[model samples]
Target: MILYGGNVVKKAALWYILIICLRVSAKNGVTQDQVSSRTNTLFDDVDDTQKQLDNEVRERLAQPKTVWVIHIPTRFPVLQLEDLSVTEPTFINTALVRSRREYQLGNPELEDPIISNNTTPCENVEEESSSEEGNVCDSDRTESEKPSEPEKCEEQEEKPGDDWTFDTQHKWHENFPDCAGQSQSPVDLPIAGLIKTRGARKLLFVNYNEIPNNLTLIYNGRNVILTGNWPRDRTPAVYGGAAHSRRYLFHSLVVYWPSEHTIATLHYPMETQALHVSAEYGSFEEAVANSPKDPLAFLGVVNIYKFDSETQAGLRTIINSAQKCKKWSVSMKPMPLSVFSPPFKEYVCYQGSLPIPPCTESVLWMIRRRSLTVNRESSLAFHSMLLGDDPPQKVFIRVAQALNDRHIYFFR
Candidate 1:
């Protein structure tokens, strides 16, 4: 029996009905072979009838001065009617019937027909529509497919010399060979070694008594930096103890949290670095280029978060200023340099390199032994600010490097 269907759902339902009939016949004592034979015969009869119709259509289409019109339904509204012509009537008829069947079955492969010519057969119209639809469907499927495992891994892999982050420590040596050197910064300070050291000179701070009134809070990719608006001649300088008679000019200050390195098995909740360059160099870039060996000094101060209901006045100002500036943005405000400075002066001296990349060695590191107190409210505020806009990694701290026979001196 032949079934006529207008939609794909109907055709699918018809197929299910045929399968049910076959199962019923088998249950009614019909042999399996006989039931299979009957099913094949029914399909063969339908195929023959379809072939005959196609042949007849083809023969008629071959006649001269003949115009065939066909109707096609699409998901969208039928905008206009079109006439399509084909030389082989049988092929055109078969294609049209196949397309109509597939569309009714809810096949995503069917394309909308373009019916411009009223004289063309419906089969020809369907063939044109299917061609366009196939291209679009295939292209979309290809693009939407999930990427392979290897492709995802490649995207996540860190490359050498890319922006430095805490997780990218393995790639640091590849980018800057100096990172693997012996005198790298942030070395673990054993409490026994620091206390046992003798002949350590006291550190002297020059012009650090007054805080610079004009300063800006800049959110670099890694940390929040405080840049001062002090002239080259008027910039604060520090010497004494391990600072070998050479005055280090204070440049910028960076604030960090969750101490990058351990000291006497203790980890501070926050840390800050006051970066200074050699006074001999005119600019920071010049100092880095000319004195590649050891031209910078870092005064490190660690801080512990205390449970205080009120936030520190200086820290509250920084948090407020950061809220006005977007991530990775810099905004100038009337901030004081003393706000970010350490409260205590007693420190431990050591020789190390820049903790960050290009990892230049020969830096005089003066880490304060006493921990500064930051209010719990302000500490939470610091964590709220993001490092940069769309940063690859959210972590701001770098991993501590090896000590490699370096001595830690305590200067009171």
Candidate 2:
């Protein structure tokens, strides 16, 4: 409407060709619902930038609820694989699991929790014993959630001379009825019917001259021990002998062979004895279970008598340490506790029991009122050293028992 400068320049090139034919009819007159509304506004601006990057990755893996404690030491039939997991969704296959196998506890619909200790723990939760192992727990578990059983591991402590031996030990009163009571033992001493006591005394031999660098020997499967290690104030004791008025201590020597207290009617082929104990009790089964009716134990004997002459050097080092015990134990070597305490200028005392087994009658024995010759090649090498492991018949005087109403003192 204002083209006046003329025909000016031909009306400005005819109004620039009518303004490019009206923008080519407004770009070919676009339509089809404005190109489907600009292609859904460019996919709604990429779904609002993927919802702001999934809210900044779920606010950095959010996790706050404070309070989660744990301590672990556990033992015994248990399986806790903590938080066991597997929220499987195999592309929506939907498989949620939490297992631990045996002694289980992963209740994903439970059925495996019988925590037993000899039975009684029914807790079938839902059904997950790898898919209900024959599920069976609907007894309405009530006995107050039962779970108190776990005490069965403390047994070994018997030894009443472990079933007796000293050769059939006269059927050890059939499992030791104190070997048939009536106060049993190697009895039969009667050195000319002793009994001349002044309540006898004069035996105390403390530390019998120390002497003990080794000593063990042992056999206890019956006879032959030796013992003695010392210290605890140089051990070795023996209290005023005859009838040891408690002090005891000293402890081992035993032996036996062909003799076991038999002086008068003579049988000494070898003996030895010596034990002791009760130094205010601390063993010997706490001094015979706290001195039952007194005499906490003593014994002393010596016996011997083979004589062809010359094997005595402490009986050839205790018959060469009992030829290294056929099987039990050995270690010997040391010697002098007064070469096995043999100086008793006379002693015979008695009160019997315990030549072996529960033969316990709380002994006090004594005996060394003379009789120790040894030799005949050390009693035929101590009776041919347990013939390689003897024990099958031929038992020589099986420790001479029977002498009932015991009495024999003599301590002159």
Candidate 3:
């Protein structure tokens, strides 16, 4: 006999009972051939019943039924109903509703078997209904009551100091595509490719000898920046060494601790970037806004933390001042230019761009090979300083960019 209009679970339970009966019969002295024949007969009966149910479903779907809804329990939440004649069929597209309750066809008299969150299906479904009686499949709830699309939890915004940092957020290619350009900064200096040559030309430091007693130090959320009013006439400047007789004016000094990748590549504990802009440009802002071909230079100095020797007085002054200031705070005191001055005159000259945002190209980079030493205690203090209200970023370093066709010129 064929079972008609029964739940899938009931069919499954029946199949389970038949298997147990066969096993019990076999234990009661039934021969192996007899058991196998009985099992085959049971499977044939199941297949014939399934074929009849499938045909009935097809015939029911083909008819001009007033309402059609199918519910199938599967691994994923899938609405199995198709050919749903509704005003807004767009919303019926495979909605991934995550729920534990089962769904079933609803009664045609009360309402259409619309998608809902009810625990039970329609208890009194009629065999037939009229379309004029408002038998339409749709969401039972109002448009406003429906749940919105689930937000992607995996793609959370990169919080500061979490997955992003001052140097990391402004990534080379991901965040900032300009970083992938031909002229990018902080490139790995391989000893084999360096062109050792005589001193290209000495960079004249005007008024850099005079040490200012008090200077302004500010934590700009990203780095410890030293701010000062540049004198219009006596502003310290550097000329020569690819400057093409043009002078580059001093902008500001930024301090940072080497990131893990930077330490592995450069073997430096600390790094200081002395930014400079062409004298032709009235200000640093103008230089940055100008074309990428503008003559902007950065003198990068690497520093090593030392416990055996005396701590650098310049680093100590900044570290002590930072201890007093909060994130994004500034302090004005005597900060001599000599404190940030490059200790070694020898440097590796290369054409590169800024390590930070707007990674403008056509920059003259002077990386000093010789590293200065700072107090270990003071160097460690940098980890405690926070960038703005962000969590403490122990190191601020950019990943090394591709060298491409750039050449490194060493001048002693």
Candidate 1 error regions (>4 Å): 1-162, 195-201, 210-213, 295-313, 324-326, 387-393
Clashes of each: 11, 4, 9
lDDT digits (tens) for residues 274-376 of candidate 1: 7877677777667667645444434333333222234333444455556523434444544334444533344556677777888777577776543334455
Q: What digit string (tens of lDDT, one per residue) describes model 2 on residues 258-343?
A: 67665333454676777777666677776666545564354554544333234333545666556434445666555455554454
* Superposed Cα RMSD, model 1: 38.2
lDDT of prediction 2 = 0.52
Better of 1 and 2 by TM-score: 1
Off by over 4 Å in 3: 1-176, 211-214, 259-264, 295-308, 324-326, 387-395
Candidate order by decreasing TM-score: 1, 3, 2
